[model samples]
Target: MEEKNMFCFQCEQTAGCTGCTGNTGVCGKKADTAQLQDELTGALIGLARAVDDTSAVSKKTWQTIIEGLFTTITNVSFDNAAIEDMIQKVRAEKDSLVGDCNKCQSPCGRTDEYDMQQLWNADEDIRSLKSLILFGIRGMAAYAYHAYVLNFEDPEVNQFFCEALFRIGYAESMDELLQTVLKVGEINLKCMALLDKANTQTYGTPEPTDVTLTVEKGPFIVVTGHDLKDLQLLLEQTNGKGINIYTHGEMLPAHAYPLLKKFPHLKGNFGTAWQNQQKEFDHIPAPILYTTNCLMPPKSSYIDRVFTTEVVAFPGTVHIDEQKDFTPVIEKALELGGYKEDQTFTGINGGTQVTTGFGHSAILSHADTVIEAVKSGAIRHFFLVAGCDGAKPGRNYYTEFVKQTPSDSIVLTLACGKFRFNDLNLGEIGGLPRLMDMGQCNDAYGAIQVAIALADAFGCSVNELPLSFVLSWYEQKAVCILLTLLHLGIKNIRLGPSLPAFLSPNILNFLVENYGIAPITTPEEDIKVLLKQ
Candidate 1:
């Protein structure tokens, strides 16, 4: 690997509001690791394009491609060795495809890997469009990885990962890149659907459940991020060990799944969102197992207690390998011995508990009553003001926006962003809480299902419904979800904590002109505008 500073603008935390061209990422990724990630991405693209046909890509090749893309995602992996190993696996996969390239009479030049520098220096428009595709598939791979672990796989979603990576390296013009960009959204919709099916089928559909903010006195483990499989395994390993597991961040909604919730020691949720972990986990007598994204650089107070598994890694943190044994996480909880008494914590708004599990099944079960209430004018309009929450000061916009919604309007939410207002007692309409927690970030699928179902009930398209999406994005998953919404032709979305740095003026204008996507203004102003629309 080169010993030079790396350039990466793939995420929200890029340096100086542009790219990270330094020795370390704002998220704490070291310079050498960034180079390896870029190298891995380049090799994967070459492997993807080199195969003469789709069938020529073996199962191992596909696995290598998915694992490679997912690992490069921001805050997902920090181990240079692990990244180096994955890069080698990808290269080995490529070598198998290019076997006897020199001996063959028909030599294909497509086997060559395109340098990532080319895309980085390309015209801003082409760069933005291709970034959307590459980043989208990276996010989608997390969802696909979860489903595959549970034995659910969709061939189309799998195929697109290869195709999009291939295009990212080779697509030359704006027109060619734009096609793959939109298709990222389209395929991700399928990928998220596949994950939804896998989760629901394996764990049973989620139901409404109230999660407490209090931590029980004893040995306890706090699980964070988007992986239910990791959480489930931990629950099993810690079951009879006198330890309790509390969900945090994106893992909060795991409490709703029938199979996961069945664990007696699963207990309740701990912290508000990923952004609060540095404060919440400090001096806490428990281990935080990060299974996926939104891993902030750990603090010294709790650094030793934080263990990462799967794609989530921070250098010097104990990494649980593919064996998935969470013994370290369990042992750390025991060593800390927890609090002397049951600790009562409150949400940011001081509520004692938050409610989740308002997934598609639960919401649609009450669909007729919801439609009746809408017809009777009991509910004025619906606002879907949810996505990834961040540590930025302005992110309080979501809390204020949710608070300012008309009492008659129902607020639907998913992902960590809901933590902003999830603990608030927003009351209810027709027996359903006005602010409904629609599971995790992956449960964006459930939110989509509910939107489509509502549109069907009202004899209109989803865009024609009274619902409006006010989304806050911080990572690649949010990017993929945004693309999925655009692919479905949903319009008038409001995005913020500032628009992505990746979007050039022209690319952003293309979005604004074509889809009516705009950044959030003041909550007071945007709510008034959206309500009128």
Candidate 2:
């Protein structure tokens, strides 16, 4: 391992299903960028230690921690300069908390910055447990950051971020770290709920709406990533500017929010999932604005039109700052002038349109209908097929799995993964679409609400209900959501296309024995096993 320039396995697409240990990662991250990210993480850990050992934490302190964590998420920040700036910000925050610690000669090492290499090279079990805590919070931080952007702050969630980082950097025992790992899940549930409240209260509960796949003529901007506030701001700024706005990747769910979807020029979806961006965005006439993660290193063909905001940063791309002004993106869109004609695009399933919304509120609105339909044996089972999508092979299993679901089952999906089958129009059950898109990755909160409500309505625990979790994970957000499901005591979850490389044999066995967690098999076998058919 010392022979390698860097080691990273945080994402599912790591090299060789192990770790990315080269001059560049499979995600196109250079060794230098990876090194800077590690430095940023270490600095963040140091800042957490400072906050842990100091007085009351400030909002700015939590914001720095959240932004630093979000920046290290896969594909979020590829710019060396941006990462370096974050590292400095974290270090400065630590310095402000533990002032003059550097001047002491008899210094206790309690406030020292952690060396991430130590964690990377620790005992496999310890590393695996800490990885869960680290990666889980990294995902949770994205949610927390989103909520924070909407002026919604939860002190418990903020405090836990520091606690988790302190534990990640210092905790040595596997049991201690494992406890923290589950706590990550526990706290992340709360964090997600905070975010859910912020989004719904601010933007209005999402309602089911059909989104087209066509890119209308004239100037247009393609907004991607998971920030609804950023989307709203862009929508506001671009209003009456004669420019159409379309969503891409995880931002596809933005169409369902009442406040966001009301804009007349908020057009439709532009492309498929984030993994296909390089091809889908190639030579496109519109400028693409990334408000958060899932940003690939743009190809030279469309690099000029790439605009990023918030924690997402790629070198040479135009970035929207805290002011939230999107003039550059608008100007670029106007200059490109979009398609000559309205271009109709189809999803992977060759469908011209896809539907979203169907949040927990929307789905549970017809609670009596769903409960009655279940009692009458009209709905046999429920499958929550959701999570991130990636370019990894064997991901076609999701498409096949959704397609092969029984006609009597309701297949609920969320996040970018739905791009595979959201267009397939699985017909309907009790006037409800068999395939329901429940917004972005963060909408796992809504899914949980739906599951719990169904369990209560049926007079059974969620585990005892006719519900199965067939999840596809690609990055850290998926990690936290899976942890949340485990925290809720849900079991028999089929996870794929591949397990996390960070999971040691011992940790993996623990999950399998206690939680019924297993790698996904073929669609037919898994469907049978899950349904007992």
Candidate 3:
């Protein structure tokens, strides 16, 4: 048998402008790890078909399916051990539904593990639709996982995972697969909503919080990714241990949550975007904990001190297992001891602090003021300039785009992408900050809520409410969010640092024609076009 290398095109940085058709992925995923991820995805699909066949989807089975798909997402898990472990869980779930294949009298192919290569080599249109369903579910699973961590699980959302994954492998016709594609978007809205509720109900509705870029002296730990529960656990473990906790990447918005910020030792943020971690973390004294995806392969300089928990694991890094004790992370943080003197850091723009926590409730609390300003012409438009940030060069377009927004416009942002311009100080209008950081990308739910409230207050459709979405995407989370926006009939959206390579020309054209989706151009030209509209 010919040796298998790897085949993955899940994110924005695939090779050859389409798929990772070589030994390694653009994200630095090794060939063996990539193939293992494919196997995991295949196993999850098989598990889904099994769950559907039996109609007995246990909570454990549901979680296995969700986390398995999420693990296969780009930059999520690079550990062959972790991927193989998850594959076993998925395979075990299938076995639980139906006994060993060899022991069964009739071997039905309904629940057989479909080789991922089949979908990869299918007709272009069918492959595109199936990829959308698979990738979209993978993204939504991240939100569901966060919610699950907080003990919130929606049966509808969980069931959809099985339904969508089942369709990915078994659904044949283009028309059949199209429903699954849209359903991924429709279901993701619920997933994000569940996460928003989980976060607010558990952590308290996020408030307007101004977080500094300064990292105090002494022992400290940098927590990154989107899992609040992991951050909370680390905070609890390190509370009296003399270790300061600082949020990084998507975890930055954790400071705005009342429950998270209550710990006095939970200090300010560290580093910039996830893509910048390699350079930023070089020679750093603190151990960083990755709670979720968007993890680049750790560089050797700091890999020894890097800790991963939940589904995030990178080879030699210490991984906090099911107990989630985080003692290893704590020990490493204390071992580093941090800088001798207090060090104050600034954002890429040289701003010492950035404001966050303008979640749905916070923004809606100022609805009257916001509406009055718009009525008084003090605020002319609202620009939602946010999404996943990447290492891609042209991503600076987001910074330029936000800088060019009219002074009267209220800019709402969320996710790691906001780092591109979150510190630019766009000033305030109607007593509210002109540029509001509305939590993480999952808080796109919060942005949606705020937009709906604005539209309702003004008695107009969301798209008619002087709001525009100019998003930058690098991963599947953005894909699910974009699909949700489209499902809601929002129009004239701009997405860039280049659209997904997986999007076939026909699919891209369909989106453009139906939803007015377009790739972003120069900020000067695009800003003028959006402002005029």
Segments of candidate 2 deviating more than 4 angstroms: 1-4
Candidate structures ordered by lDDT, highest first? 2, 3, 1
- Over 4 Å off, model 1: 52-54, 102-107
- TM-score of every model versus the real structure: 0.97, 0.99, 0.98
RMSD of each: 1.6, 1.4, 1.2
- The per-residue C-alpha lDDT of model 3 at residue 131 equals 89
Better of 2 and 3 by lDDT: 2
TM-score of 3: 0.98
Per-model lDDT? 0.87, 0.93, 0.88
